[model samples]
Target: MGETYGLLSLLPIAVVVITAIITKKVIEPLILGTVVGAILLYGFSFFPNWVGDLLATMSDPDVVWTMVIPALFGILIAMFGQSNAGTAFRELAIKYVKNKQNSLLATYIFGIIIFMDEYMNALLIGGTMRNLTDKFKVPREVLAYVTNSTGTPVSVLLPFSSWAVFLMGLYGSSELLDGDGFTTYLSTIPFMVYPMITLIIVLLFIFRKVPMTKYVKEAVARAEKGNLFPEGSGPDTEGFEDELEENSGNTKKPRLINFVLPIIVLVAGTIMFDMDLIIGVILAIVTCFILYRLNGTMTYSELFDTSVKGIQDMVELIVLIIAIFLLVRVNENLGTIEYVITSVEPLITPLLLPGITLLVVAFLGFTTGNYWGTMGIVLPIILPLTQMSDVNTSLVLGAMVSGGVFGSHVCFFGDAVTLTSASTQVSNMSQIRVSFPYALAGLILSFFIFLGLGLIV
Candidate 1:
């Protein structure tokens, strides 16, 4: 679409990032950037045409399916709260996870277990564990860091996940790869250094092996003083508290099954049927309705009402996801990534390609706040580059995955970051400010590791 724009193609991405940083609001910037991209692509006369295109894109069955799944999952999350299952789980967690170290460890473990979808992982874990972590004076930011770290990283590492399936599709369709897409993806797992090292960093934080950033330190200190969140550091948790109180009044005791059974159904259904996450979550939601109704904890009407409320809760995030999709379409049309890659192609060497690819993908992810988009744009380009050079294909592929994870992990306006913050009640910028140092550490470590591996392999 941007056969003639060249470097001017990057303006939309620049507008998105700069506007987001200045305004601390994601939706407006994303919409604005998308409109700007449309204007850039088709000129002043195409605004009406662009509107038609956006409507068509958003209404496409595949787009609607992807957008609705996360929102449906949100209903399951809210069901947990409505059933008081989250509170019951928290009480159980408090019984066993007594100290800060164990709480952090448990958080990490749960994050890893919910690896099928990053959105579900962040929302479920962050929501379920925030109160527990606060009991031990662990900042919401720390909870966010732990939860966010395990999300996309774990999803990409685990071959059974949606992320793996998506990557496999990308590879299978590409002309460069020789073997089965699933096989290639499994092979690349071990070499995903950014995600691997990022997990290590989380462990170090849990074990007190790594020094906390200044912001994190202040958060910890404030939390120790019984202030779970620093003043003005995050959003209000009053709505969450009210929701919990409303649910906790149910006469029936909250059972752990309310939490465990649904997650089991979700995960197991996905694995057993080789299905999309939407199907697993749908099965889980049906299971929840039966269990809750049969146990006298919720009536059919109340369950229906609560499920609607849950979907309502996710409306903002759903809109944000749609905006991200639109922005991605805009970038695709603008050829921003093509311009970026071609601009840097001449300077790449076999020894430097891995590191450079990692940096470039990470930069794109950071700027675009869209990991899937970054991977979609960069992988095809980078994979071909690797085949033409003396580069190790697996290592380069690993770097690509790592860079996407790194960007999603650290990008302030990223979907994962925003989801984690909302789930934990932390402000977007607060989470970003606290987690940036750790993400930076992982990025630097990955860059050097890939550079060395590129040279050796």
Candidate 2:
């Protein structure tokens, strides 16, 4: 971060944000940004042969490993989906939950279970439950809410998650804290106000049978009128007949064991083996094939083709993740991240940490507009702060995650929001209109909880 052409260092970050805005796609923007960053690195003499170095580094095993695992997970999901396995799963889940509320709850339950990573949780749950919720008139925003609420906090709390590993490395390097990874991460979980409150909010909505928000309410009404898109998508009169045709003929008779047995296998396999999620996901995909084969859903080659196609659909997401990673990395190099952390660190008292952290996280989340990117930047700062306060690290980490999810929840511009809007076939504004108020409510509640914990700790 030497000052000569320091401004140039920020070009890549800017490139990404601007590209994301203009193209509304991630892969190309990131790759372009990487090239720009390489040029800057060369011009600034940041490294010897920096341009070549950066290009080589782009394909580094660490970088590629990050790409492969998430992409692999996406591939597995795509496979299951394309093979009509997900459609079959949906048909079966419909039989069990019959009630929409229960169906939503089941989503919450699995969202909590897939705590190994946030991105994994977002894509996996969204892919699996998309059709089921669609069948029951649930908005994709609600599903996004469920995924966002559960993903981050659960990972922060769970020792085995990639979040834990990164936090350990970041915090461990800071010289601000001295401790083992387990103690450090565990100490921060309770203070993660957003996810905790989010879970509570979800339960309240389900248990109280809360009516959907106004936009969501309208979304539902439109859905029932046989239109999932906004009324402008050809309106429903002539369109409804065609939509009915799209949904009608392929509805498979529900298979109890086809769904039940595989889920049991998946849950059991992950827990019993204490598996890495890549392995865990691979196991799940394998289970899909086995169940499909057993239940006579598709022949072997068709399963392979569907899985490949499913994985292809998520290429956009994989590119987004990779690009977001580079954007955060550039932020780190540009000193913007450090400037914010240093300027804000002293502002945090035991009492004020919760509110301030949440506020700051929201701002970062909004600017970066990425949950994982937000967490990657913030965790390094807060992990050390927890030691400074001599507080419970888990609670502090919880607050960190809470703040991130809080921002991402309302960020209609984020990848998750985009995907939710896509799957629901709803307008972006519709997702925003519905998610914002809900996000605000959850944010306020989570802030108070963090304040309470900060006071107590």
- Writing each residue's lDDT as its tens digit, candidate 1 over 1-457 gives 4557897788877787677657656678778888888888778776886787688767855457656765676688678767767556566777899799999898888778677668767766887787788778888877888889888888899864557756765565455688766668878888899999988888998898999788888888988988877566554642344433344354556688887888898878866776555678789999999989888778899789988987887786567656766676677678665675677678668898888888988886787676665675566557757876758899989988888898888887778887788777777787888778889988998899987887777
Q: Runs in model 1 with CA error above 4 Å? A: 59-62, 114-152, 155-191, 211-252, 325-342, 360-401, 404-436, 453-457
Give the Å error, residue 270, model 2.
4.0
lDDT, candidate 1, at 446: 87
In model 1, pairs of residues that clash are none
Model 2, residue 274: distance off in Å is: 4.9
lDDT of 2 by residue, 277-327 (tens): 456556777887887787677678877886676567556655655554554
Cα error, candidate 1, residue 302 (Å): 2.7
Local distance difference test scores for all models: 0.76, 0.59
In each prediction, how many residue pairs overlap at the backbone (N, C-alpha, C within less than 3 A)?
0, 19
Q: Which stretches of candidate 2 lie over 4 Å from their true place?
A: 1-65, 87-191, 207-267, 271-274, 324-350, 381-392
